[model samples]
Target chain A: MTVIEDALFDLAEHLDHPGGEELEATVLRRINEPAPFDASPRSRVRTWLAVAAVVVVIAGALVAIAPARRAIADWLGIGAVEVRRVDRPLPNGPSTHTVPGSLGPTSPAVDEGLQIATAQRRVRFTIAVPRDPTAGTRSGVEVDSRTPGGLVVLRYPRFTLVEIASQGDVPVVGKLVAPGEHVDPATVGGAPGFWVAGAHQVTYLDRSGRVRTDTVRRSGPVLVWVAGGVTYRIEGLDRVTAARIAASVH
Target chain B: MHTMDRRSDAELVSGARQGDLDAFAVLVGRYRVSALRVAYGIAGSEAEDAVQDAFVKAFRKLEGFRTDAAFRPWLFTIVANESRNRRRSSSRRTKLDLQVRDQPQSAGAAVDDLVAQRDQRRRLLDVVASLPDRYREVVALRYFAGLSESETAAALSCPSGTAKSRLSRALNMLRAQLGEEVTL
Candidate 1:
């Protein structure tokens, strides 16, 4: 019992718990401050003003979508991925269902999706496999070749990895993130990336800007990065595991 | 520099109850790291704010604190509550990342052995992180915050027996997953 207890403490020491900074000053400062009035008219006015400012900003972004979209795509572009901040609520309709890898009635790409060997042979770039120990053997693979270079989806037991080759001045993959959803900067194999947490919409676009309805789905937390001109989207894993796998991709 | 005060927590608590801000400040300095650890386990990124809030709340409610009771556990209860509240309101579970130690392996250690140990530690961390919130909370309060079983129970608002059983169950699960690799 003592051994296990001591071992637990040793392990706890390695766990990177945050809040290492000196907090005494902040606590004392807050204590010295007067208590806030919860329902004061002044507080309510401040709240409304903040909400009004957010509304104006969101409205401005929406109205500027045409020119803003391209600039955003270029600014946030990592290899073939285009990251866009969308202000509207995610569609609640059955068309944008949460069931991942399932194609809609109108989309026929699922039928066209190929096996791993086939996907590897069909794509121009190398189809790298995740080398993380827990990644295990890929259960299956799906290839979508609507663009110049194909998009490959590798399905693992615990998560999914999607890869797409870089397209110059055009994005083969698009991520539309809503307000409050996080798209934190990350690094994959020494290359810049983005980690999107919470529910967000992912869209696959062709050279002509046509949405690949079959690949469209609302995704969960995903780590997106580009290494060797291949944009990789690892989904359904925590950021740390995703990063480990991302670093191990070969 | 101001002279260091060697007063016990009881003395500080007593002084704090009598509106001695300096006494409370010392108490804060002593327990801030442990309080933050508990808060971080629950609230993640919002832990800094949560810890500060917990300390303030503990200060305001100092009058109710019994001098006979252990100060750490009592303060931990408030910290846990404040952290849980923050987590509940945010509705986002921030993943905790375990860092590698800065020190190198011993001179006799082989590269393969170092790699194996690192991998084992990563797997252990993953298993710990994946544990259910209830089990994780008990483990965090006990191991991470260095709280005793009774103190963990006090912080969690549960019986000491419950805390003990939960720790046992959590350890068993870790052992089951880790197998012979877990020396403990």
Candidate 2:
């Protein structure tokens, strides 16, 4: 046999030249190889048990932190909630007389670290959400409440969210909405909710080790709230981080 | 553009980074079949496996994807690498060079039979599959990927001279394998 000079241009044609369309579904299924999130009922129970592990850590962190830093900012206004005067001023800097700030609304958005310095104190935190996309494996429901259309349907038989709020300052990675505030008219977290509207969905593991998603939109001053077990956040993450996520949201 | 339309690729990357499977899926859908076909050409029957590896790897490493570069090329690069790996691991060599030399010279073939003669396509696929790994890589980078000579060289991490010679020799080998069926 001899060589041929011309190569196949049937790429578009060949792709359209379906050898087997079922292979697409097969590849997708085989690709995921959906290993059990919990190999056994025992293991599933163990995963739920691990959620308890973070409780101690959450309690400890909250114990050392303050409730809110109310120095004030130009665009943001403080609510009627009481504020403590600590030496550690607000994050980034001391807020003047506008909005009160915490480490940030608890969202996965905190992955990028932040540093705020003023005469009083300096607040610092790091975002530690695991960003592996292929796994798509979470114990319960994987959701996208950031947008009304951002919801991801879960086929699992059971899905649940449990919120365990700490008493005071637990620089948690989640949205920071007042106890009863709503961005639009959504009932979130049993408390009124202010959802983060933006391109990126920030994720964080709460004190319970449950996953939380946050986004930041600058349409209005960003509001922060925790609903379901996940945190609803906007402008709660770093400007660069928030901007990055907001840009991707469809 | 509306606010939704105005989002940047960086944002999309970030969203994908946060386990937003839909965002990542959108990214995957864009490269889906193009990636599959390239993998298919290089991977042959194992195209499905190679495409899966590429998609999974691409999705996992998406944080490293820069918004500025064309996502398609980067995706193909991964698919190509996975296909190569699959070829190596399977160790399934079939020595399927063109068999036109074995053909009987009965020139009385029907029209449908003449047109349906995939001796050429089969030979191209066979020679490419049988070439040395390095040369085969160049051939695929050229035809399967449709890269220019320089692009082919760059993709193969070789000098253009090496890439050109590899492709030339690969074509020559296929022609030798096909004998009379060699088009050029």
Candidate 3:
């Protein structure tokens, strides 16, 4: 890179931009302030439907019913929920995964040497460590540097992993479900969670917002939950086991 | 909380089109920095106003945005246009202010090195600010806002080739202006 180019990049990376909260408040105030014209009836209907669907999901009222899927798909559009079920078990070895679109690529490299205590200090959010470390099970952690909020992965022996993030709004990487898979709503430690069974395709949206299929697929049963401002995913464990481990998090 | 953070841009745009202020707020929060950078690059003194105007316009015209397309470039296009409009209406060119608040010095850096780096950055910013409109906008979108060539094109409302050529020309201008002080 040329010196000027390097300087440009340095400025880009380091330049202090406006804080999000202030801008959000300003924009929200402006948008919410009364406007001269009212919204069209069609827009009102769509808004009602979208709000209703989100409320249902957050309230844990939407079961994995076929009809609800269509509503969610329509409401979410490109961010729709997809479920697929596969007949075979997921592979045992390490697999690479990618997040579609602007979220950037996923890394499978585990930080084998990082201790739970050290990771807790490095990350911005609270780190939930599994209280009951299964005997003879090796564990590791990896942090994806590219993501703005930072993605932390806790890997256990046999491909079981837990992905955690504090940004509750961003969707988890991968398809909502793989082929022949099922997503069942559940509660972990009194927080909302999902039980994902079987392997599923992961889809990403590139910079252009076009969906790109990830080459890597995740198999086996996985449990996902959000609590105390953190979202956690525990994979390769049964519902009971996952629940137990989740409850034991410190 | 779930409604605000988890939904994709398309979903947020849909909600915003439907007059969901919360959804719109999320979008604002997500792109505010990039929008500000793009606006500042073109409009300088009126950057803040340009951003506000662009976002307000974007909210009002949410229905026109295609849900399948990328939101950043689309939003940026609006910001860029707002900057241009502001620039034309005012007919005044304000120098870009490159001064950043002093951050705590890094562990090993000496005070002298930091001062020299700051001076160098200021000089580079001056050169960049002096470039012609076409060149300045391209440099801002590509380098300042960190958009790819295609994205910069989208923001500029130009063809990809046009954006690329403009950027190349901008870099050459910067190199020429800076002379041997900075390498391009």
Candidate 3 structure quality by residue, lDDT tens digits, A1-250: 6677888877665554444447667666555432211222234234233222111221111212222223334445533444333343333345554431111244342233577676666667776667675612546666654333455667666434444443433232434342345667778767776676665543332221223333334345666666665656666677787778777776
Using all chains and alpha carbons, the TM-scores for the candidates as numbered come to 0.47, 0.42, 0.48
* Over 4 Å off, model 3: A14-20, A37-250, B1-6, B94-98
Best by DockQ: 1
TM-score of 3: 0.48
Model 1 alpha-carbon drift over 4 Å, by segment? A38-250, B1-5, B94-119
CA-based DockQ, model 2:
0.12
lDDT of 2 by residue, B87-154 (tens): 76777666422222223445778756644444555555665567777666666666665667776666
- Model 3, B1-184: lDDT tens digits are 3334888989889887655777887888777777887777777767778888788778866666888999988988888889889877875655555444456789899999887776677778788778878898898898888888899999888999999899888898888888887532
Predictions in order: lDDT: 0.64, 0.40, 0.61
Ranking by TM-score: 3, 1, 2
Q: At residue A176, what lDDT does model 3 achieve?
A: 37
Q: Fraction of the real A/B interface contacts present in each candidate? A: 0.53, 0.20, 0.43
TM-score, B chain alone, candidates in order:
0.82, 0.66, 0.90
Query: In terms of lDDT, which candidate is strongest?
Result: 1
Interface RMSD for model 3 amounts to 6.3
